[model samples]
Target: MINKVQILSVTLPGNLDAYIRIANLWPMLSIEEEKSLTQRLRYNSDLDAAKKLILSHLRFVIHISRNYSGYGLPQADLIQEGNIGLMKAVRRFNPEIGVRLVSFAVHWIKSEIHEYVLRNWRIVKVATTKSQRKLFFNLRKTKKRLGWFNEEEIKIVAKELGVSSKDVREMESRMAAQDVTFNPLPEEDFVDGKNNNTIQYLQDKTSNFACRVEKDNWEEHATNKLSNALLGLDKRSRDIIYARWLDKNQKNTLQTIANNYGISAERVRQLEKNAMKKLRIAIEA
Candidate 1:
């Protein structure tokens, strides 16, 4: 049995160096040892078997965490998330899966870290759709230059990631943009010639009051315009727009709505487009 205290005591000075050292220590289990341990956990619900499997794979998690350091998250936190993923993989692993534990565990580990990166990388999530997630990962690998992807590169990425070219371009634009703080700079507004932090800059009473009033006025005008525009719409058109666009879980698609009204899908599309254009113009006016 490996000494838990001894392993805990061997902390390398730096995170990357620590992970590298841990990677070198990943133990190789024989075929019989691997099969026996997996069976014990899978069939017998053996806690000890699960612990042994997790303990042996800690080094692999460390190795995997090193690859994600470029995402700018804390190394220790990434390693911890990877460890949690490793445990999940161990729990769900089937002995009949006919693959090594390490191979199956890699997906789980990376999934956990990828989720962490997406959630924390920006104030809002960078990758929300399936295509965006594919682009998010592949873009990191396929990118060779600092600027946007060219036409040829976009085609290549779309084919490689199994997404449309338009999706690839949109995701590329999103990845290139950086998140900026909403508040103003400290040096831009100073009192008594004293320097202030961003927190202090936000404390300016006049600026905060003006911003709140502006936002309130905008919302009031927008709401009133929307009400007026909807009133101008015929009853059926208003119902269709409300059902398809405003409802939380409405079950009306263009084809469904067309069938209900004995109209073609093209006609439905045209109506929907005209309605949207009118709504936009009304709100802006």
Candidate 2:
């Protein structure tokens, strides 16, 4: 039986180089030996048998993780997630099913790596629905060149994938989109050496103190005129306007205002519209 600490020491390497060296140490098991060990682990909960199975498969996990290197995520992290899936496959593997352990474990390993890639590939998710997720991973392989797909190629891909040409176009657009930071870093600057942050461009340069004061005076004058206009209206129209628009906390609906006044909804709407027209004339005057 292998020592638990010894197995842990070799299986968990400090770096990729050490990981490759450690994986090479474990020899592949024959069908007979694998069945015997699998039976032992399955029926008796043998820790040594489980450890041997995991150690022998570390090389396979490393191989699978390499395929996902183009995603720009750390290779070591991908291998780690694949390792978790390999362990899960080992736990549920039925040796009686007449398939090799490697064949059974491949699905589990790829699933884990796919999940990791989708989660860490970008800040915003590239795929949300089932078809989008399928298109996201498979679309890259369909493209033969570095440039965008032509119309004939788009039709071919759409028919092959069982999706519309429009969907293919949309996914292609999303794939081309790159993430940009909302704010520029300290080192980032314009050609003239001024800070080029988004905040600098977002400020309203036309809103000076004089412009703000003039706008405020106009607003005050409009409020006074509107108040005088409301006073000129009958009590019912004044109450309906106040309830429908002036009250910030709880604006009443036309139906609710109609119920309050014992009138129909159409009457309430008419009254509100007339009130607005009078206010507009008063303010304009």
Candidate 3:
């Protein structure tokens, strides 16, 4: 007979079709089961309980990930980020809070996916502020399907989203702007050109092999030094630094980290500042 506690692992596949099939294969837990498992994980920190919770919710992650498919990112990557959010949700779940796991997990899950999409949707970042991010994922879709918004329509969108018409117009301009590609490849995509001619036209003596090699070596050494400096700091300092700067378009808020670590946001800020100073000194040396 199988034990009362279930221990199923989620092995996501590169073939999204198979992944969906396997994800949906994990039977969703009933309300009672969800409540009980959350209790076990919360009260006892039971690893099996956590595993069971994560497996049961894999299908939810897949479903939510589908909503982001239009971003033209790999489906597997979106699902993986959703899985991370689900795991975090599971870690902090509270059955006593009187809400289902899925309800609580949705915010965390979307937060992760949103960061991933914003960071990757363009070579140059398209969304930096809150309103811009809102328009990028929400209003931009409307523009894609319906074409440009009229003045009246822009006002309507602004009212609905609680922003100024000027904000919407600015986003419209940004969306319409064409991206410029820097560092165009030399001759690889050319229809007809001599290799030496292409190289001569595209690169100067300053772009010689020696300079390129030195640049790459210096970058690698600097990265290693930064890594070592981060390792020297305590875990909290490392986490704060990554969340604030290293992780571009970070979704982790200062208040959220402070709450998680049971400290003040001011304290978190000070820690981040000190950590950055240490890193700068280490890197400069």
Candidate 4:
């Protein structure tokens, strides 16, 4: 058996092509040989056997890591993370289960790459739910063929991806949206670094300021119309309406207004109701 310490001392090539060549040159172990090494490491804590098992499996991690390079992360870092996951899988592998290590370790390998992509992709997380995650990873492939999804395309994608049409539309909007700076510049500020441009941090597309302002303006206009409608009521009706809603304290109810005006509660309620109808009509008009 090769000495574990000596194996660690030797520098492994970082380049993928060279590592692939080295892994290809390693002679494939028979089942009996693999089982024997696994037993020695598992029972006797034999470091040399564990080292051999890990070295033989390095090629599989490299191959799997290549598929995740589309996420714009460094290829070398992705492979390194995949290698860590491979080591973890090797430690937990049970040769008695009658499965190849590659098959079992593929899950572990992809899991690590997925975590890496999520962590580095944005300052804010993109996907939290399982369905959203599947959409996040697979939606790119579905959208690659066309410019954007039509209604028919959205339905097909939703069925194929196992998500709701609403969820697919949400993810589509998220993907199409670009992150803008919180304090976006006028193109002149970027020419020189004098601007304290730290607000160039990532902006949340879901909370657009323009949309919020528009909503606020609409609410303010509706409130003004309501105030105007109340002013058109008779003095007593208007007083009763103000006491019910706009008074700061000791807000008068129908009984309280009736006591103040020496009228029955039913009469006070009638006046309030009629005032409300007139206000609604005025606002509608």
Clashes of each: 0, 0, 0, 0
Full-model lDDT, candidate 1: 0.78
The Cα local distance difference test for each model comes to 0.78, 0.83, 0.82, 0.79
Candidate 2 lDDT by residue in tens digits, 1-285:
224322332235667888787887899999998998888877777878888998898999999998888778988889888987888778888889998899999999998888888888888888888798888888876753535898988898889898999999999998888976658767775537766676666767766999889999999988888899888888988999999889989989999988887999999999989988987887777
Clashes of 1: 0
lDDT of 3 by residue, 1-285 (tens): 013222233557668898788878889899999999898878886788888898889899989998999878998989988888888778877899999999999998999999999888777787799878987777867777768889899988889888899988888887677654443466553445534333345556565788889999999998899899988899989988887778867668889889989999999989888988998888788
Q: Please identify which of the two predictions, 2 or 3, would achieve the higher lDDT against the true structure.
A: 2
Model 1 is weakest, by summed lDDT over 10 consecutive residues, at 1-10
Residue 279 in candidate 4, Cα distance off native in Å:
49
Candidate 2 Cα outliers beyond 4 Å, as residue runs: 1-12, 144-146, 189-196, 199-285
Candidates' RMSD to native: 17.6, 10.6, 23.2, 11.6
Clash pairs for candidate 4: none
Native-to-model Cα distance after best TM-score fit, residue 204 in candidate 2, in Å: 16
Q: How close is candidate 1 to the true structure, as a TM-score?
A: 0.58
Q: Pick the candidate with the highest lDDT.
A: 2
Give me candidate 2's TM-score against the actual structure: 0.64
Instruction: Write down the RMSD of candidate 1 (Cα, Å).
Output: 17.6
Model 4, span 38-69: residue lDDT tens? 77876776877777877787777778988877
